[model samples]
Target: MRQNFILQVILSILIVTMPVSAETTIYRFTKIIDGTGEALLARDIAVESGIIKAVGNNLDRSSNGNLVDMGSLIALPGLIDAHTHITYGLPEAPKGNAWGELGATTREQRVAAAKRNALLTLETGVTSVRDLNAGGGIDFELRDAINAGAVRGPRIFTSGPGIHPANDPSPEGTDKTTPEFLKAAAEKRIESGADWIKIFGTTGSADDLTSRAYYSAAAIKAAADVAKAAGKRITVHSYGIEAVDAAITAGVTSLDHPVGLTENHIKAMKAADIIYVPTIDHNRYYAQHSEEYGYDSNVRANLRVFVGRNIETVRRANHAGVTIAMGSDAVLTGFGENTCELRAFIAAGMSNAEAIKSATLNGAMLLGQDNDLGRIKVGYTADFIAVSGDPLTDINAIISGVTAVMKEGVLVVDHRTGGKVNKPNCGTLY
Candidate 1:
């Protein structure tokens, strides 16, 4: 009897400790966009064990799983935000005190606000995000929590604390801003579970809207070398022509917010196969919400000029065949509204299909997740969103028509029948 009891106890322990298998789910869509700029087609996708098992016209119904009939909806691979600050929210600006708003909130309050922001982001069909920076390693904790299913945010690739100049909000805290110090900063981020490293190659919008290179070519290369050796990618926050040129020459994976990129800069980015994420929406948001953010007249005027110039820059880069990826640079007010950047790309002369690819396959390429996360194919992760109408004809449908979202074969947002459905009992989604 004692032996039987021991055997039962051991079996129970094994069952409890083993990873639980995810339920197989079969989703049938009326129209499908594979994220390759392909024409939409009718298809049925079968997902088993959180991976796409098959995708075809008629899949076998023999598999034991939930069959979700997404009626007459246009399906596309889940959207990805190449740049985001998930830990920040729209601050209630006191009179003439934009910076002080952040100081008023406690760490716990900021984290809780971040969680809320993540859920809103997912609801907009953004299944993946690259969180560039957050203070005190909160971004890392948020990423881990989402991955472990402890929270319900997007699949996050984070840089815990970015390497910035002393004038920036989150500086590297190094004694000297040299090549060696920058490399050490990158290494520290890697040791802290950073999937990528972000370096501020130029000044920020709040400081001065110039594209002066903060880090020299040597410094950028040193940081990039360290990240590459560790099998990680590096992106640079650059706005000026000099900074863009230096970042591209240093072999950075992507150059974020290259507002002052020239013809030479575009050519170099193309030659190096470096991605250009012109976060036009970032400036647009600031300009639109200038009064709310307590921006003075000069600050607001700078934003307006930069917005137009940035749009022209994007048009020039796209015309020159530079690879472009959409990043909202969405911080507080633009969390769930990240898709506006895609529309900006369309306005910059890209076709609707091209703009969509910027947010989908191009984003996957930046993260080195092209084979698994960006496309709706056999053996890919089951990450997709459904909309009410075809996005090809009216691209605005991407933002307005999101109906259902599924990540890893599990439904997270269902807005059919005009009622929003978030994940029940899911800490992050709710």
Candidate 2:
């Protein structure tokens, strides 16, 4: 088993190093579900130099290129995880068996752990991610590495760190955090090459489910102004409705993890075009793995109740025509289960098609890459995943059925039979 794992890692290295060529390649699928619609069309996708050249029925074979016939597999645009902490923790077991394992490593170990996470994240078919935070400029560096082709992982758009009182930059004269301090933190993140700014507008997660507001409406608006002036997007994390009004008033690009939103907040968010990233699955993950966090029975029960409230909030939002994006809020044990949030979307009275869109077009729109990343259309980047079942009928087909993956026209992961391939998790992990 050890020898096979070693060989698969070596093979993955070879595949990642493979060069791109101008020669066209064709991938024929049983059915292709473009993110724009509800129908699954049987189509062939042609690629060259990592860009989709053509997508149609029975693509021409006159141009000499490789042709891969994906038997009994359906295709969908590669998924985008709108919220993640990909750099926060390691996928492997901790050196010590406690939640501190999340932050137990040194700088070097953190970097190494992040690299492992990058690969593992790709193994789950997430081609792009909007990482919410990784303090100390680590997320920024990871994004650069992946962009430069030095790392074999998902495309990362990161916020280096969030504007939180827990970190430095508090007001010198008073104990309370001010608008200036928050705005300055946003500027620093933009200066650090963050594509997005994260605002820790509420204090909740892990064992506690309190919905305390971390910033005033003015402070959040000040930070939002900074992000807009710098041409960067911002997302606010609010556990409940405590920070929703402030987030809406600030005009944040998205709001994460908020539940019990009032009718006013919902209407305002839709009016402002603010996307909602519910991230309902992360709490479920913590509740399920209570031992790791030393979460008591009460905490677990609270988490379960929170998930139900979050899903109900989503139902109301969806009914009101507000945009919803899928976000797993993946950390520690949550990397491979990144797409699990789609299940929550389905449970929230969304059809399977709508749930899939939250990960595809909806997520791409939130990331401002709708044209290139969301659909299997001509002239788009060839980033997609193939699964054994059609996601239109069952959301799990997209969540757990990804069998092959391509990023920028490179066949990075293939887990089909005779798939003697890929990483620490390899074929078995999928």
Candidate 3:
């Protein structure tokens, strides 16, 4: 009896440690735009264990797996938004205070709103984003939940809270005026689980439009140093020539808004190999939704001026061979409309293919996720979107042409059949 009991225990242990076979998914597409600026062609993609297993003209369908026929649709890598605010919302006008909106919501309400925003964003074919700011650790918690499969949303790389200098009279616990203090602030963000460090290198917003450097070069460098030591990247919110120069000199990973950038600034950015994320669509959004956001005529005028100037800067940067990444800087209402920036890039003299690269390959490089998320290669993650028309011919297809969205081999949105394939955790918000 004792020998039989020991044998039974050994068998149970072996069974517990055995690896389960991963489900395989096969997707057949009529055309594939691999996000490498290569020519488009029809192809088949096979995914296993959430990673792409094969890509070829004719894949064998004999294996027992889920088969998805994306008939005649243009398949492209999943879109990426390099800059965004996941937990921010614009309050309704007539009763909304732009500044007061930040403090009005409770933490629970903000998290709920973020979940809704994530669903809306995912439906638009954006499978990844870098959220720059959120208060009270909400962004961190949201990111963890998504990674744990407890929530359905895009992959998130977030900076818990942006660091900035205190107002005059220097509020307590908010002193970022010195290099030492800036370094400490960056370390604190890392300790709080921030994937990247964001610094307010210049003043911005409707209240003030002047692009002046708020932090000296030393301070910016100090923060960059800390981020590098911790194996993280740093992005700076900068505008104008002086602030842009300061950020470049400090070796920042990306510069947010360079509306005031001169030719000299562009040259410096190219020399430093810095990435530029011109949030041109953000300015246009405010200009178009002036009344909705409670902006006055002057604010609208300023935004329009900035939009034109920002586009010109982007053209100059592209011509100079500077890496440009797409970032909408979209707030709450702008979630689903984030792809509008891709259209803006085309209007700024970039070819349709180049604009798509900015949203896909270039974006992945900016987030340091190129190894697994950017291109539709054999070893990369199976994150892709399908549109009805050829995006190469018509850039508008990126905005209104998304028919299906697949992230990690799971179909989240399938507009072809008039409904989503796999229902998201939070139901449709729009």
Pick the lDDT winner: 2
The whole-model lDDT of each prediction reads: 0.78, 0.81, 0.79
Which is better, 1 or 2, measured by TM-score?
Answer: 2
Better of 2 and 3 by TM-score: 2
TM-score of each: 0.87, 0.90, 0.88
- Candidate 2 positional error at 322, Å: 1.0
What digit string (tens of lDDT, one per residue) describes model 2 on residues 189-276? Answer: 8887889989888989777788898888988899999899989999999988888888888888999999999999999999999999
* Backbone atom clashes (below 3 Å) for every candidate: 1, 0, 0
Q: Which stretches of candidate 3 lie over 4 Å from their true place?
A: 1-22, 40-42, 61-66, 90-99, 166-175, 420-430
- Give candidate 3's error at residue 98 in angstroms: 4.6
Q: Give the TM-score (vs. native) of candidate 2.
A: 0.90
Best by TM-score: 2
Q: What is the lDDT of residue 413 in candidate 3?
A: 80
What is candidate 2's local distance difference test score? 0.81
The root-mean-square deviation over C-alpha atoms between each candidate and the true structure, in angstroms, is 11.0, 9.6, 10.6
